[model samples]
Target chain A: MAETVDAGFLVRWLVAVAEAVDREADRLTELDSAIGDADHGANLKRGFASVTETLAKEPPASPGAVLVTAGRQLVSTVGGASGPLYGTLLRRAGKSLGEDGEVTRERLAEALDAGVAAVSQLGGARPGDKTMLDALVPGVEGLRSSYEAARAAAEEGALATVPLRARKGRASYLGGRSVGHQDPGATSSALLLAALADTARTEEA
Target chain B: MSPATGGAAAPVGIVLVSHSAAVAAAVADLARGLAGGGDLAPVLPAGGTPDGDLGTSSELIRRAAKAVDRGAGVALLVDLGSAVLTVKALLAEGDELPEGSRLVDAPFVEGAVAALVTASAGGDLDAVVAAASEAYAYRKE
Candidate 1:
């Protein structure tokens, strides 16, 4: 089994993400309605739609190019803070991949770490703040193990946000009311990592 | 472009980023009106999502920043949350903007007006950004 990812695998990963987000759009929106503007699902749906369209329009030659193009589309299409946060994630990760034809798992993990750092820097949100960083930080950390482990870690991290008070984004405006609700951003981030892990597993199989 | 060669061609530009399209355009209009509607600094509005919804678009900001950038540079003022994130992401994409372009963290309306007024007076990019940042200290009391 190959331990490396390629552009084709990345494309499939994005497709999986789009499909997962599409399926869970309503759930994500429901979560956001509690603490956010109730647009997380719709925003990501639109952004990922644009990404798929861009991918179909101009197929990227490299794995880095694929992620970069997807990031640009998300930044342009998605509304709210999630747009830039997700966009920066993929863009920074793509840049870290450099011009390599094949991406090693270690390289991908390193790139994801950089991407997670960029998200924290851009949003000023930390793990306990009940933002996407809650999931993303642990996801990146788990990448050091295996894709399945990363996926599970991301899910756990996202679930951990349920007990946290919001300290960032629109949710923060709710103060104490933000507790006891799962963060929509963290949930969506978990989905993203899940999609990546699924893709990796499928490719390896 | 350097501020040392200031002229009509090298005036500092201002960009207003907001979640609402109407808000951004209205603020730009208000700033322009305050500047007497003459050859004041170029004020561009990069507001809303690409679909005209309520959200910030980095692509739109990048376009507006490029359009308004003459030679001096651009000063960007954002409204809350994702607007700032979008701008930061755009900047982090490496060498996307011309030299000296910056994002000013201040009150959106007041900062836009102040930055525009300063730019209209031939202020450089740093000066325009400073004016916008200084608006944070302003109190209505």
Candidate 2:
């Protein structure tokens, strides 16, 4: 399990996320319309598109640089709370990774834990808050084992949000009305982790 | 810090953040207009996205904060939701905004007026912030 990921691998991972967001934007918006302001999908779509564009224009030199650049791009372009929250997540993770030329699975897991913590701190949210943390907390925990495990855990966490009343973000305004709908942020978080898992699997193959 | 000639302390600067570029600018103008005819303090507006859409942008806020920083601390007044969140993100980045900068929780329009009047009178950051926050208790009935 010592397979290492370089700058190129991180770029591929972000591109994968961009593609996934593009493919699922409508579904994400549908989820948001149920309990939120209905801009999560568009916001994420723009943010990832900028990430893809920025990476192509001038690729970063290391895994840390890659994540940092993508995170900053998201913060500047997303135009919503997701922008800063996701930006802080990737930026903190990149900072934790330092300027490593290649990152191992265990190292990436540790970095992701730091990233998730930053998100939680920025949002002041816990795992039961029906926010992205619902999926992200479990995803980082599972990453300590296998990529497949992490992906599965993230999906489960996202699905689990359907029954929880919102305690954070715009959705919280709806109170019990938010219970029946799947959390858009958690759902998007699952997509992001799934892309990470796919990228790791491809690298291993 | 006081001037070499022992003049009054530098007045605090003010910044307004909002989702719409026009709203931030309008609010800033309103504050300045109502601040009375004195050596007015710097009141800058940072609103909307780079695309000029209806959302806050750190870049715009960054530029506004920098432009209005005059050795005195900067006081930020923000509109609802994303405006506050985006400014908080910049503040958390540390070094993105000027030192002693703070986000004051107050009503958008009324707070801006109170803050600007206090700042123009050479009020320190604390006085400026208190004025804005105290605007909430003003009876409108």
Candidate 3:
């Protein structure tokens, strides 16, 4: 089982995510530009950077607070479609954190469900929309299944984006042209799931 | 996103240095995806706003600096050239930037990861960003 998360660990966790985004931001944008706005990577980077800034101003007392606050920040800072979607993910997950300072498997599962639901509500897009939802929905489900399972599911979801026609967000503007390209959101979502698996494995040892 | 700045009640502030926001979002997705029920830190980007470029990331640093607390200064990690100059401009622009705030230019990819890993290992934003800056050496090599 994962050890209880402390403030330092939580900070690092958040930072790690930022770093991952930084590394992949260009790729995400490239995928997005192919079918969508091309701003997904940049937009998300900005939103998270803002979240980091906001959090620095008022560091959360617990893990839940941190996620929730970051979520809220993302929603507000990110102007495009993604801001709200990602914002919901963090906000809902944060809520599940409850008053407890630490995170547990059960709590995380519940929080992730809430996050997924929030994304569903915000985007009104289903699993096959060729959006991040494609990756995210499966990712949360995978987390429940097992870290490795979730990672595999997420990867599958990301690849599945290849044939999808965009039904939501900027990519949808492309019509049939969106068919051959993979959804940026789904691709990034898959990466996220994969990263989580990596983190779990790395942390385990 | 929010412009609110620091005080005793603030959180540890973070600086996000990337080529653009799209990349930033990807990182956020990665962060969210990897979240195993832990707290993810707040990070603001030094560049790319739908409205404008934030007029040289220096402004971003200035604003970010004031946004946090005494110990929580802005930490910078950039994606490319001129961003270094931009950060310098921001630092030179005024006294508003907290003494705690400093620029961290690490290899874009490796720096972010190293900083993050360091942060996970119990380093502060300053330390994490610093580690990230060190990773910039890889770019030089």
> Best candidate, TM-score-wise?
1
What lDDT does each candidate get? Answer: 0.88, 0.89, 0.65
Chain A of candidate 2 compared with the true chain A, TM-score: 0.98
**Least well predicted 10-residue stretch by lDDT in candidate 1 chain B:** B1-10
Model 2 Cα displacement at A205 (Å)? Answer: 1.9
Compared with the real two-chain complex, what DockQ does model 2 have? Answer: 0.65
Question: Would you estimate the TM-scores of all the predictions?
Answer: 0.94, 0.92, 0.58
lDDT of 1 at A189: 96
The alpha-carbon RMSD values of the candidates against the true structure, listed in the order shown, are 1.8, 2.5, 18.0
Candidate 1 residues A1-205, lDDT tens each? Answer: 7778888888888999999999999999999999999999999998998898889888898888998899988887887789889999998899889888898887888998998898888888888999999999999899888888889999999999998999989999999999999999999999999999998888767
Against the native complex, each candidate's DockQ, computed on alpha carbons, is 0.79, 0.65, 0.02
lDDT of 2 by residue, A131-161 (tens): 9999999988888988888899999999999
For residues B50-110, could you state the per-residue lDDT of candidate 3 as single tens digits?
Answer: 4554222344445655553335455666654334434443353334366556667566656
- The pairs that clash in candidate 2 are none
Query: Candidate 2 — which residues are off by over 4 angstroms?
Result: B1-9, B136-141
